[model samples]
Target chain A: MDIGYAFLMCSMLGILASIAFSIAYLMGSDTRKIVKKANFAISTFTLLSFFTLLYYFLVRDFSVRYVFLYSDTHLPLVYTISAVWAGREGSLLLWLLYISIFIVLSTRRLDKLDKVTAFANIIMCTVAAFFNFLLLTSSNPFVRLGFHPPEGYGLNPLLRTPEMAIHPPAIFLGYAGMTVPFAFAIAATYYREEWVKRARNYLLVAWAFLGFGILLGAWWAYKTLGWGGYWGWDPVENSSLLPWLTASALLHGVIVEERKRGMKLLNYALAVVTFDLVILATFITRSGIISSVHAFARNKEAYAYMVLIVLSLLLGLVVYIKRKDFFEYDHSYRLRERLIQGSVLIFALSTVTVLVGTLTPLLMHASVTRGFYRHIEIPLGTALVVLLGVCVIAYRESMLRKSVLHSLVAGTLAGIVCFVLTKLSLASLGVGIFVFSLVGVIQGYSSRKIDLRRAGAIAAHLGLILLFIGVMGSWMYESSYTNINMGVGQSVHAGDYTLKLNGFREVNGNAKFDVVAYVSVYRDGKLVGVMHPKLIIYNLMRSDRIVASVDIISLPLEDIYIAMGGVTPQGVASFEFYVVPLVSFVWIGSLLIIAGGILAALQRREEKARKGVVDAEGEG
Target chain B: MKKLSILVGVVVIVFGIALAMSFKSELCPYVTVSYVVSKGEVRNVQVNGTIVPNSTKILPNNTLMFNLSDGKTEMRVIYHGILSHYQEGIPAVVVGSYYDGVFHAKEVLLKCPSKYKVAEENYSTSKVLSKG
Candidate 1:
């Protein structure tokens, strides 16, 4: 059956089995055999389905529509593997497979909490059914006719870049992976009060993964697209960023709630919204609902199918809320919960603002000034303001405790020294701001409060500070030379660096093309690095794309870089060089953010162990 | 807390002033072709030119050295991209600053000459490669 039916039938059977198992759970099923059997059945079915699809793509099954559209005989094996999720239908199948695998792995060690475990199964299976519906009715993987062709339309050459080749599935793994947590949240809402607590630890893990995944996507855009800028305000990018921003907020808010029994509703809502937004993001990206050149779900059938799926889920949510005691009085807080309430407000506002802005194109014709509610320049501006507020509250909040408030104060001064060494203007203020946040992270870590779970939170905040400083340095007051001509051994000055065009050579890569212009960069009359800016004409596209290869002479202080040369047919190549001050700090900051997530993951795990919670209540 | 509030105020004021000034001047780079099309800021542009042997830059080089048609209207351009044989000519829009001894180009968008458009049908990739 070419593995297509195997995957389809297995996923279908698994979904049906899960629905039956859910009914059995509610009805007091005998020995839990039905659910257990279904879990094994569904997981195995999903795994097999994935492999079959992979085989089709690998072997260049031109008969299969997806393979024909995305894969060719000349396509490398890795790209073929990535092609498993190159389009809407295939990606959903990939999502279903990944979540099913996640379900198996999560449930392996979990022994008790019968209701939560069942809830997890219920959520996954139901979501699987939605994907299956789309697969079968609208964008079916196995949809085909009789004629067999020898060749197929190859994957877009733009996507053939080494970074983009890996981007789709990795990001999908992140986006769809959120479903597990979302399902868990739904289950937690019904079964136990401790469910929220138990779910918090796993939430950090998911958040951490999602954050890194998003950053990887951004880095890929910077390197491959040759846009010379990372993080274009694209809807797809914003869709991913919105969840990350909220996840960051929740990662920190979880700590406060765990300790003080505050922000419970905020925590719950954040969980739901974060997961739902993952769905919303899916609708935006996959349904061809957003303005991007890359879209697979353009037909009415796919659109209607997606709308039906979304509407049904919404209806389920409304009915679920009405039926259950969603908010309990037991976890209630005092009226003086300004910080908690403010935090929630900030998170909701920021997440929604970004969300609305991300969908600005289809939703309405927004003015250029109000680009989108959740754009990087505006939405991130608001988020940064909120983060600054969080830092203040955290430092003051830490003072309430007796043990290490003094160390935080001392560390603040030490941080000032570090910030000054970078030679930034407004040095003292930057120093104070970074140091205060650094102290919060220090205090958060030192008093046995820091673990891997909370580590992500701490690191994220630290990364934010670094990002702010690095961006301000790189983007602000940056100088460059627009047009200049020189030949081999010729030199021209560009922002703190003199670039000497060493020579030109042909660079033959996997994607066959010609790359010329090999240049050397010198800052302050000293050789910094080599820059090979190539104007490549792709073999397949018969089109051109410039590749700027920047060698970062990285330091805490500055970095030297060069990008794709501007070369005409007459042998005149133009190169741009830069001695960017303190760009490495951006990467340093990202590391800190990931580190904070790790901390949060560890601590939240212990807390989960204590409270007996699960990960992501509404993942399904 | 009060000091933090004051800090916020200061930042807002600074941003407001900087923004006001930016609107009066060019804080961001315009598109390369736009600058070329606009002919903004004409000057004697110094550039590093790599010889493509017989590319866009080479055609001009050929015209200039052999005096194919005109004299003294030649310009030196520094460009970043691969070089392919194009002495036969193609439709292209070149934008740059024209000044003493050079038209230093910021951006060049080129299209290969279509064979179907030409008469006598002496067109193929092989012919071009053999010439190169």
Candidate 2:
């Protein structure tokens, strides 16, 4: 009679209904009526299940085991809702809900192609069924407690930030978005070219979301984790990067298959790899086979995930073997084609390297350091930048000797300027190549008639150049770890600024306490605003958890970051200061990259519409 | 097109060599405290263990010294840097070398324990107490 039981019953009904619908679709039944109605019903029930869980958290219903574990009376309303996906069971439900909505939207779009839509629905529903089973068996959020507790244990102190509310959902959306493309890839194995075209827009949307999600995670780590650096090449982070890399390769490979009818098999394989990697990422974070900061507690759901992955791989292998000859293309290769091929190859190689590095710990029982990753990534990244420069010059045309010469000169000149500015040797060379690519793309865009598709590619390439420059400047030439102890009115010099401890204030919140430090900064004897860095301690069920807050003064060229250490018995506060150069450009470049991806998706939609009109005219 | 392929092949080979060389210099393989104790005073090696509770001390020069234990063996670690907020009895990884029976740590990374570990323990204990 409880809400939890009702929610569980609804979810169980959804699973059974979807399974029946999938069976009907796979049997070549006229699934038009069944598909539409079942998709609507399943999506509605999943939403209701999610909302029911949310209702429990909102009402402080500690009788439900999940609500008791993650929420308390003192927790804020926003985080109360966010805590719905903060743990294992609730996050799986969120994943199921997103996939159900995707199935409804995608099935609606492919209404004209009934057979292909039916096949795609079978694929989507099977995925949905797997998650539903996991939720039902191992990770059911609807489980209840016999005894009612007066107060609930609160959310993890580390996950109590504003970014925690957005980060998980963005990542889950990225993971769910890939399912549409995977379904189309399965359809492509049978229907080939037509399905590939249909899958392109979905692939772009997924790639864009994944990239945006990654940037948001990096921002969260940089701001909340109190680490001066953004990326640590953690196992969980690398798991997400694996899919993004393969998806990037697929994004380019599909273009080749679209224009030249080549790389068809590669595109299909990339799609499969992207989806498998998404599931693999989930497994890696949940299984606890590897140590990661983002992992949930070790659970039995890992076995379920592994079984799903193995079955998917076997199915993909069978399909690839059955239709081996369908991927053959007879067109002679061209320069532009070769450039695209090179980029895809580089992406594939990078993904392999990261995958090996990330899994090495589990296989060999030895962990590779972040330094090992940088060794492979930096040189490979620099070469990719150089290749992008060549590709921009060779866009829509064969490579010309004169253009090559021009690019070389531009690169060298830019490199020299960068060397003079930053005084770092190899990174200057990287900047030089980036600037050369930027110039080439700009020239190409301006010389041609306005084409949004090509413009989107150019914008993305430009964004990469900016991102490379920012990373090089910050990583190669930054001052850090300058610890200074100062009392009120005592000044310490760091980089080009003077930091003076002004005062401190204590903040007592409902669930936590904070000691906020007021530090004044001056540049060239000009006063800047006061920076408030805090040390926070949260009241949990058993003990208090401490977290440091970073205060950052961001500008176009650099950031002045300060983290409060603590106060000594002598009344001097300890602070760590870092002057990171050109880091803002990284965020700016990320925005540009996201914008370019969205622009490209819009252009694809327009192109598809135009093609539909032309086909109709020809039929007439 | 063949020439372009050849050009890419050459670039990949060159980058591969550079990557391999960089890997050699950047390799920081983690060793256990027992391994470090057996092989004394090795340079640029990492060790992973747990920080012994209440064994931490701050020196006059602002350096921190603590005992790092791996259940069976314990070693002293000296770190000279800004110490972040870290809990006692948690897992930690120290990046440095062993010298004169102590770990001269260049950096110390503290790992967060599973939040549910305590809850699980409490639940089991309460159940046992009720049965008794």
Which candidate number has the best TM-score?
2
**Evaluated with lDDT, which candidate comes out highest?**
2
* Model number with the top DockQ: 2
Please provide, for model 1 over A395-446, each residue's C-alpha lDDT reduced to its tens digit, 9 standing for 90 to 100: 4454534423543465457656755675554544444555555555455455
Error at B36, model 2, angstroms: 2.9
Report how large a share of the reference interface contacts model 2 reproduces: 0.27
User: Candidate 2 A-chain TM?
Assistant: 0.93
Q: How do the residues A1-620 of candidate 2 rate in per-residue lDDT, one tens digit apiece?
A: 66644665575576567557756766777656666777777788888889989999999989899999998998999999999998888888888888888888888753564666677777788888888888777787878898889999878766777776787787778788888888877766765535666677777777787888788878877776655778778887888889989988988888888888888888888888888999988777555556642233355676677788788777778877887888788768677778888889889878977887787666653566677777777766776777787776676564455676777788899899979987878777877787777776765566677666776777777887788788877777778864687887899988788888887777878787677889999999998768998877666674435566889999768888888766654556678888888898888877787777778889977887899999999999
Give the CAPRI class of candidate 2.
Answer: incorrect
Q: Residues B1-132, candidate 2: write the lDDT tens digits.
A: 567668878977876776566555655666778888878777787778898999999886568999998888889999886664444687888888788988999877766322212111112212222232
Per-candidate TM-score, first chain only?
0.83, 0.93
